[model samples]
Target chain A: MRFRYQMWTVFLAVACWGLGSVAQAAELTVSAAISLKEAFGEIAAQFEKGRPGDKINFNFAASGELSQQIERGAPVDVFASAALKQMNDLDKKGLLLAGTNQPFARNRLVVVVPKGEAKVTSFEQLSKVGRLTIGNPRTVPAGQYASEALTRAGIYNTLLASQKIVFSENVRQALAYVEDGNVDAGIVYATDARTSQKVSVGFPVPANYSEPVVYPIAVVKDSKQPDLARAFVTFVLSAQGQEILQSKGFLGANQ
Target chain B: MTDPWFSLRLSLAVATLATLVVGVLGTAAGYFLAKSRFWGKDFLDALFTLPLVLPPTVVGFYLLGLLGKRGWFGQVLFAWTGWEILFTFQAAVIAATVMAMPLMVKTARAAIESVDPAYERAAYTLGKGRWRTFFQVTLPLAWKGIAAGLVLSFARALGEFGATLMVAGNIPGKTQTMPLAIYQTTQTGEDTTALALVAILTVTSLAVLVATNRLAQGRPW
Candidate 1:
């Protein structure tokens, strides 16, 4: 009985090993910016449906952080960043293939206040508020954009004099401050504001007020699935992907 | 040597100050818990170190809620005087103090317990008051152990992550500490800066560990 049981176990192990080897799936790791999380989750599901035998893994964080990981020799296959600075840094380091980086979408910077608050109406009124929440411009791209826009409007120093400025770690957090009414108002991406019902846009910062808001996508050169990465990039550029982005309030590449 | 570099120095400074405050408070609490017994003493002992076991993000969240303007304590403070602790370097210190408290407390407690109470009693018989006994006799004898605890707490404070991130929110030169700086570098794809910060932390951690080991070993004689 013992001999028979041992043989049965061995046979089962061999069969499982054989099956595992034959049907093993390829894993694709993609690191993306925090803003792309909701959109990318939908894209990953679609990508999986088309490529049945592959699994997609994702790591989402601030674009700056994602780029730093790639630079530190992280094994990310695809990188989707909210800004071009980090991508260009990787490109300069030869970590990314030249010409593979493409601008995919654009976002707008807007001033937001609590949903029911009647204190502020126009961007100019933001100056009258006692507090304005923003992300730390040095580390967060959205904050940098807000600072640039405020600078261009030439109200940056004026706003500084009248209001307390709360610096958050990311634009989403700044949005949260506004949503929760923790600050009189906050500066965040328009798409980020869409996720919360507790905040409303006071006004869009004019395009000329700040540097262009563009999101770039690129395939890391060290990717194990270079072909798949390229395919994924193409999919993002396709009309279908553009539709997904546009539906979520992001401007498509052509826009 | 740039903005990040300046941020790095500021972070180190904050962590150092945080370590000092936590060390003093934790050592006093640890000594009391280890050497004396009173009502609810055990519970109080555990409370001082609870932050160690609790999730840092949770600590940060509650801390934010507590320090925010609408929170009870903050509201009272604001009502009494126009003062705000949230989103400031002072808040960073509070987070670091809470996060590193357990290390110092646990370490100091162990050292205090390891010293035989008979020695303390002998000093008491030599006409020392409880406070004097502790400061003059018990403290000197246990100084090495306390030093070890201090170093351990300092190292723990230097690497504080989630709580600092949550409460301090990574404001460069204001709330950013070493771990936050490293995290920011990695996020931004500034590999050189990240790598440099990592090396610096590694060396500092090793030096602290060495000092901790020597202190823990007690006097050779």
Candidate 2:
């Protein structure tokens, strides 16, 4: 009836509003790791406020996943990965603009347990007591770092043989497993662990605990706005961007 | 090629197993509802119809709560067998089955209801037993509808994503299905593989749907 037509009209109006695009000087498409969501979001806001004409669009996901998107020609201007291996591979493939791929930030890996857990306080105790959730080492750099650290601690194979470990698609999921109380513990970046209130860090691995977790940023060779890409990368390495990242529990790439 | 094929094989395997389960259970449940008038029938109908309306993620999240290791049923099973079902192929089948069952049930119930009660009364007067009358007379008349519903159910099962991901955890070479593979690849901007997987899924579902339509039409082909 008349009411139904009005409802349809309202729905179409909302849909059109959603589909409308904003006019801007330039849109800088940046692909960053999911673990960098908070830091990058804040930095993007700061950048936007400073230059109202330029807009920043971020595609956040796992570093490996982001790199693969960049590899296959996603419309991304800047690529930032949580792990160096993906950036190194992209650079080797000549996908990055020369001299633009630089380490912007670093992260530390930590083991977290469900909030208010009673057992398994220390890193070594994890092998004896709780199911451990880890990212797949084959695809996730955080997983590799975790496995290496466990190997150094001499418990990787033991946990494997005991079938005490499960794997997730990414670091955030590992944290989720712990947060949901589905797994006894999870290995994730310190920044990821911090994002979840339902989980708490049980222990932080040493800085040189395993492979270094340096985040590398680069301008894509296919970038249409190479100058804009360079500017964004420079901003990420700038004192302001570094301060924002540090405030979000990330370490500087150098220190 | 083989890499994507693994996901395709897993998707087909999961959908086939799920369709088989829902096909039998849905048809049986549909027939029961059509023939019987019992307490809480309206409530049961609403419950069975819910999956069709709710978001897949909501269904998936509920499945996790019910079947996860710490869940009531899973906790008991874990205590008895030291086995948990989450993050495995079985969980994927379960997710697909849960998602596809509602469509089958709804379609099947309507099909069975459309059959005349006079045929059952006639079979009974001819000394045919209940089960025999149902199987011989009522079922044969209504089977095309059920088959169509089952095929549609299979199509839904193949596209299942959120619930499957919630329970099965998308472990490659294990629980990863074509839909999840497409999602993973597309997320990473691996479009060639993703597009290939998308085409495979589309063609298979479309073929099944066309066949369903043909069967429904009683076409000679």
Q: How closely does chain A match the true chain A in each prediction, as TM-score?
A: 0.87, 0.89
DockQ of each: 0.02, 0.02
Error (Å) of candidate 2 at residue B135 is: 37
TM-score versus the correct structure, for each prediction: 0.54, 0.54
* Per-residue lDDT of candidate 1, residues B13-132 (tens digit): 556667678778888888989977899988998788789889887787677667655566766776788665654566677888889889888888888888888988998899998889
True contacts kept of each: 0.00, 0.00
DockQ of 2: 0.02
Q: What lDDT tens digits, residue by residue, belong to model 2 across residues A176-240?
A: 68888999988888887776677888889877769788999999997889988888888889999
Error of 1 at B163 (Å): 12
lDDT score at residue A229, model 1, on the 0-100 scale: 87
* Candidate 2 accuracy as TM-score: 0.54
lDDT of 1 by residue, A33-79 (tens): 86776677678778778888777666555676566556544456788
Clashing pairs in 1: A64-B187, A64-B188, A65-B187, A65-B188, A67-B189, A68-B189
Which is the leading candidate under lDDT? 2
